[model samples]
Target: MNTSATLLDTLRAEVDQSLRKFLDLRRPLLADPDLAPLLQAADEFLAGGKRLRPAFCYWGWRAAGGGPDPAIVTAAASLELLQASALIHDDVMDKSDLRRGMPAAHKRFEALHERSGWHGSARRFGEGAAILLGNLLLLWSGEMWRTSGLAEEALDAAMPLHDHMRTELMCGQYLDLLEQAEGESTFEGALRVALYKSGRYSVEQPLRLGLTLAARGELPWMERLCVEYGRSVGIAFQLRDDVLGVFGDPAETGKPAGDDLREGKRTMLIARALGSATPRQAEDVRALLGDPALDEAGVARLRAIIEETGALAACEEMIKRYLDDALASLEQAPITPESRQALTGLAIAATARRT
Candidate 1:
């Protein structure tokens, strides 16, 4: 394998090990037998992921002249916990039944309630438990970062960025809900949702956090690189995700086909489709877009509309443009040669992934 690929694999392994160790240490603190199920749910939820955020953080540190260090790995792994919290909460908000091809946290709890013959409404119990689980994971993320064993000065320097990342994530999620509530959205509106909801947190912030931690403070060029390169790559990543939401195989995406359509996500693809659609096509989309009971036929029809309207091609072109911008920014970045290459590989992987 090439150097960048090898390093990425190694970084993933290290982060996984760090997560396992951290969870094991925390296990004793949650010693109650009743908490076993919650802990197990967390474990299952966390067991799968691309670990992209942590990889970005690690490579950002390396770019800033930081060397291999277990402390950094531990710090990077904390982002995974933050990611987990987001996904768990998001699944509940969307009322999604599956995640990573397994029953979603709420569904798992709902089934548990049913099996136990609980008196309360199973759905209510499930949603409440899942929300609590998400909150717990969010809290744990902060705890893990604070205790990552990095130097006091470094940790303090990075804390503000971390705080800002979490704050932005919540705001973005709210914006997403607001967009759905408002019904159809403009292309600009959809792009705004994508930028804040997933892009900034997924790439820019993680890169900035690592750079800040390694530099012990923000450098002048760091912000520029993050904005120019990180932001572009992040947006492209989310764009690819929007495509996968409709076109990806269930086996690869771990969700039912066209789940995004069922959930009525106001993605840029949808915005573009609506923009270019005929009256009949627009009517069909509006009718079938958000129906929870959308069957394969409905999905197929919607997919055809999206394709015929050229939305899929438009989104693909946008992804390419963003990726080009990101890679161009990297070419002029005054970082390590190895990091530039690795970041290039990461950018490609993020934008080109099937899941």
Candidate 2:
């Protein structure tokens, strides 16, 4: 197997184990039977992810001359909890019904309410419960990071970046909401939303967190590499995600086809399409986009319009350019050869992945 693939698989297993151990340790604190379901929900939600953020963090540590240590893995795994918290809240905001091929957190809670005959409004109850669950996970993420056994100095060094990352995530999310409310967005506007909402936290900040932890502080070269490499890959990763949100296979992505269309996400792809669309094509988009009752036919029409307008091709080109820029930046990074190779592999995987 490829070394990067092997490393990613190993990291995934280790992260999963770390998460399980952390959750087990916390079980006693929330031991009330009434909260059993909440714990179970957390477990289930944490079970399915690519573990990419943790991998990026681990490799960033390695790139900064950090030696192999289990403590770093534990610390990196805490990112998964943060990711889960964000995803749970994101699903509620989008009013999405499915996540990872299963009912979304809110939907599950709503069903629980209905099944028990215990709520005035199952929908409201579900949304409330899911929100609380997301908050709990966010709290646990901080606790896990603090207690991951890394040296106090290292944790302290990285703390500011950690706080900033979460703040940026919230800001990005609010920008996304504002964009949706405004109905249409320019390519630049959509790109800004992508960078802040998903790109920064997903790749750059995680890598920075790891690098800072390992170095006990930031260096000029480290900052340069992260900006040149990490930022480019992060943007490309989000662009690919925009493509997948519309065109990816359901089985692979674990979401309904054209879910982005249904949600009316004002992604860069949509912006590009609208920028060049004919009057009738634009009219069709306005009519069908965000329709809760959108069907496969509507999805197909929108897909066709996106393709005919060359938006899809333009987006693909942009992804390629950004990915190339990232890979190019890696050639001169003063990191270990093994880490250099691994980072190269990670860059490709992030932008080229189907899911």
Candidate 3:
């Protein structure tokens, strides 16, 4: 296996351990009948995630020369819980049905509602339960971080980044919801959402948090470099996701084809296709933007239009540009060569994931 694979294995093991730690801590709290259901929901929601955010957090800690302390693992695992909360909320907002190869959190709740013969409307109960559980996970993540034994200065410096990540994530989600409702799908609009929703939180903030934890007091030009690097990689990830949403095999991606199309996601692929489409092509896209009733044949036709519009090539080209820039940023960072290599490998793995 390659170094990225090795690091990924290590990251997974560490995150699994940390997750067990957290579950142990929360086990007693879940003993309450009212809270047990919520905890179950949270745990199920977290079940199939790839642990990407926590992996990034750990690599960030390592890249900054932060030792492999159990406390650092605790902090990084907390980040993953935050991500889980965000993802659950995001799925609810997007009205998506599947996530990480399983029913989305809200859907799972709804199913549980029916299976267990809960009293309220299934949809309402599911959404409400998922939302509250997601909020609880976010709160627990923060508490874990605060109690993770970092220095005072480090905590003070890192808190702003943490807050920014949550705030910007929510704002990005709101922007997406607005775009979907209005059908104001544009390339710039999509890119803006990607930046706020993913770029900073996923890439830049994790790296900065790692450095802060190491007590490095912020390196020269770190913010700019991380932003540039993060924006590039983050956009690439989203673009790739857009591609997968349309063209990927369901067996590999673990979702039905055209899931995003059915959801009417205002992604870069959709935006670019709309901008360059002919009148008929444009009409085709507009016709299906949010048509929940669209069947497989309709989805197939929509996929054909999106591909024939050449937006796929544009998206791929853009992904490459970001990848190059991110690698360059890693080279310029003032870190040990080993750490830089590890970070670079992880970045590549993140951008290159097929499922």
Among these predicted structures, which one has the highest lDDT? 1
Q: Against the hidden reference, what TM-scores do the models get? A: 0.98, 0.98, 0.94
| Pairs of residues at least 3 apart in sequence or in different chains that clash in candidate 1 | none
Q: Is candidate 2 or candidate 3 better by lDDT?
A: 2
Please give, for residues 1-355, the per-residue lDDT of candidate 1 as tens digits. Answer: 3687888888999999999999999999889998998999998888999999999999899988899999999999999999999998999999899999999999999999999998989999999999999999999999989999999999999988999999999999999999888996689988998899989999999999999999999888999999999999999999999999999999999999999999999999899999999999999999998899999999999999999999999999999999999999999999988899889989998999574
Model 2 has a clash total of 0
Clashing pairs in 3: none
Model 3: per-residue Cα lDDT over 1-355, one tens digit each: 3466776777788777777777778898779786776777677666666676776666677766777777777787788888888888887876788877788778888998899997879998888877887898889989888887777777787788788777888888888788888888788898987777776677667767776667547766567656766567777777777788888877777677888888898889888888889999999889886787879888988878777888888888888888998888778777766567667776776677475
Model 3, stretches more than 4 Å misplaced? Answer: 353-355
Candidate 2, residues 242-323, lDDT tens digits: the string is 9999999999888999999999999998999999999999999989988878999999999999999999999999999999
Relative to the true structure, how large is the alpha-carbon lDDT of every model? 0.93, 0.92, 0.78
Residue pairs whose backbone atoms clash in candidate 2: none
Error of 1 at 263 (Å): 0.4
Candidate 3 TM-score, true structure as reference: 0.94
